[model samples]
Target: MKQCLHFLHTALFARAEELLAKRIIDGDPLAYFLQGQLYFEEGWYDEALAQFEKIKEMDFQALYQLGVMYYDGLGTKEDPEKGVEYMKIIINSNSPKARHLKYAAAYNLGRSYFEGCGVKHSDKEAERLWIIAADHGNPKASVKAQSTLGMFYSTSNPKDLKKAFFWHSEACGNGSLESQGILGVMYLYGQGIRQNTKAALECLKEAAERGNIYAQGHLVEYYYKRKFYTKAAAFARRIAENDNIDMLAKITDCLPVYIAKGVAMATFYLARCLQLGVGIQQDQAAAKNYYSRVSVSLQVHSVLLLVLPIDWINKFVSICRR
Candidate 1:
């Protein structure tokens, strides 16, 4: 039985199925559960339900799936009330097998309450259930619960910002991309924790690597501000590849005006990338055009400083040349 389960875990589905078939012939309940899971994945919900129902003593996980099927109208009529009842049973169960099931059951029941699905809508009740699930040692439920709590406390009093920070931090540690991005912003601004630019950059970089678009945007700005042109250009090119009209407009507009340091630097880095072909195809003509604009701006700034001492003017010109 353990070998069969190991095979299933390793994705040797054919051998696992054959082993499960033999176990089912021998009336093994665990085999029925495993077979039901396979059928469910295959979208043969009717067969899955049949196998699940044949177990004389259904474990909480199997029961939870039955509840999901009823609620989702898979091989059964939509019956949210019945679904709620089954979920409650798992939550109330004392069996050690109910350990993980309880977390899922609590989360699902919380959603039911929050959405008024077979239950009265009650924000307080929903929050309570989610908290229970969060403390139940399931990473997925913990992420959901922490994210909800973080958002809830974020809009409250200053005192609650700390609470929000704690929840977001917890979720971020659990690999929640949204929480990671939010935590990065929080750290950047010192919202709930001490301002730590290094920490903020690390969090934003991790989130960006995980495909968080908001984090990517922040990282692009961060690298640009620090004059890490190569890094900034790489990120900017990625964003440009996405072809977001609003973002492209923002990037391009920065080139003609000194609206913000980060934006201006990003524009400069992008132009430099075009010039040097660093992480992008080089276009000398386009690069020269951008460089001309920069040179003109510097020349105008030097003219403004002409009223200064001769030494100052010479120093300024030398700086510009460099």
Candidate 2:
């Protein structure tokens, strides 16, 4: 019965694909959108770009896809300026077809302003755009803007912890994995929220179980602080050595900037454990290697020029001195 169902599903999917291809030949914009999304998900960036560009004038969704592809340099030379322009076009639009996409485009535009990718760095502009997106938050798709608002508030000059907490809570409730981990930290630190150790642990554990690398990093710190060196070592070992510099370089699109901090924390904690022989079998030489890598990661990932948390380098200085 299972095999029959699987076969039926496959047959149905193939038929749909055939119809989609036919519609593409017929110049159906929606068909091009569907096919382009399929290609995007499958990592066929060039084909996806081609399909989206074909319907760019007719669909805001296709324009969004084109912006993302150019922004990420998936199928073309990295052109953040062009991507930013595309997003801006969507935001200025009043077409009903663009209503659903305005929030997404605003969020991406905010990021560009924040990072100075195509525009001069402007926290004011970033906040404005993020607010536009966050105001339109929903269970689907708007969580990123919500979570980003939380991050922005947390780091804003004179920091609005209350706003940060509120946004993170909203994002977490809406099923944002990143916000879930951040909520744990806020709870643990009593940052704009009451301290609740039990809630903190539960939130961190749940987020970690769901494969949130950010939560995993903090979990390592939590265990290490509690003297659960074995568990900390086990987790930090995996996180610290998980080398995906390529992804790290281009991580700005969908991930929080704090992700670099998380990776660095895990690496630092792992190095500390190795130096002291606290958990895993330690080699002083290997510890030194990780220690050096921490600094290198702080410098750059070499692809998209992402610097892994240089702000936390002071934490490693004492360890290096020893």
Candidate 3:
């Protein structure tokens, strides 16, 4: 790990990648997985696919990862049908640990079906698969299931409020900050759970402390709603200080959304540099130009989050103003 950090800091990308490949070839499934990730990051789709495929031979999660890539054309041509085929193999396998893969497969299959991405649309089929996936312990699927169930309940279908609450709570407890933040909002507004500001505050605080932007925004909103300016400012300061790049730079993917996030973050730091006249003169015009370019790039990439969090917006605003 220390060697890897040194390589990254020294920007020896090629050597680092070569070393990673060596590790992969040395019979390390994790190394193979990471090599695949590195290739994906470098946009060497074919190479990435090859590495992931090798890992798939021994790792079920690797299989699922490949299935996702294939489905989204991350490192290969978009082939939802083929993706579904691979998922089906995992879903039908009798391996004990394959249950989680099965759930993931089912969820992906349903997503493909629902979006007609690589299959025909079928709401009924999607709902069925979502239920199966949720039952198999897929936290994401569980949240979706609750959402769909909530929609159903609005039409006088027996509203499984308790079940929805349970699933959302479970997903939150399982480390899904989106779930935590959403559940926090629901509790705060009495959408599903009992109206309990205290519970909402606790949930949002947990998510924010863990570096979840969604949770941070919710925390801000919670504080604002309750006129807690001091708390809001303190959390905002935390946001300003957190080393987002340290965490993000560790990810080795060139996904458009992720790339956009990186660009945005980098632009923000550059702005900070200019504001403080660090490593350069304080040229507000140049700083603004950089931010503008990132904004345009982000817009072109369509990474504005089909569902953006408020904290994200706040971050954007703060950086832009600086």
Task: Name the candidate that leads on TM-score.
Answer: 2
Segments in model 1 whose C-alpha atoms lie over 4 Å from true places: 1-12, 72-78, 136-141, 155-159, 221-233, 236-322
Model 3, range 222-309, lDDT digits (tens) per residue? 5544655455444443443433433532442112343344345445445444555554567778667656765765577564453344
Give residue 185's error in model 3 in angstroms.
1.1
Please provide, for model 1 over 226-290, each residue's C-alpha lDDT reduced to its tens digit, 9 standing for 90 to 100. Answer: 76767778776655344243453354321111222222233445666777786567987766655
lDDT of 2 by residue, 260-280 (tens): 556767888888898889988
Worst 10 residues of 3 by lDDT: 249-258
Span of ten consecutive residues with least summed lDDT in model 2: 301-310
The per-residue C-alpha lDDT of model 1 at residue 14 equals 72
Reference-based lDDT, residue 223, model 1: 73
TM-score against native, each model: 0.63, 0.80, 0.58
After best superposition, candidate 2 residue 188: deviation in angstroms? 1.2
- Candidate 2 accuracy as TM-score: 0.80
**Ranking, lDDT, top scorer first:** 2, 1, 3
How many steric clashes does model 1 contain? Answer: 0
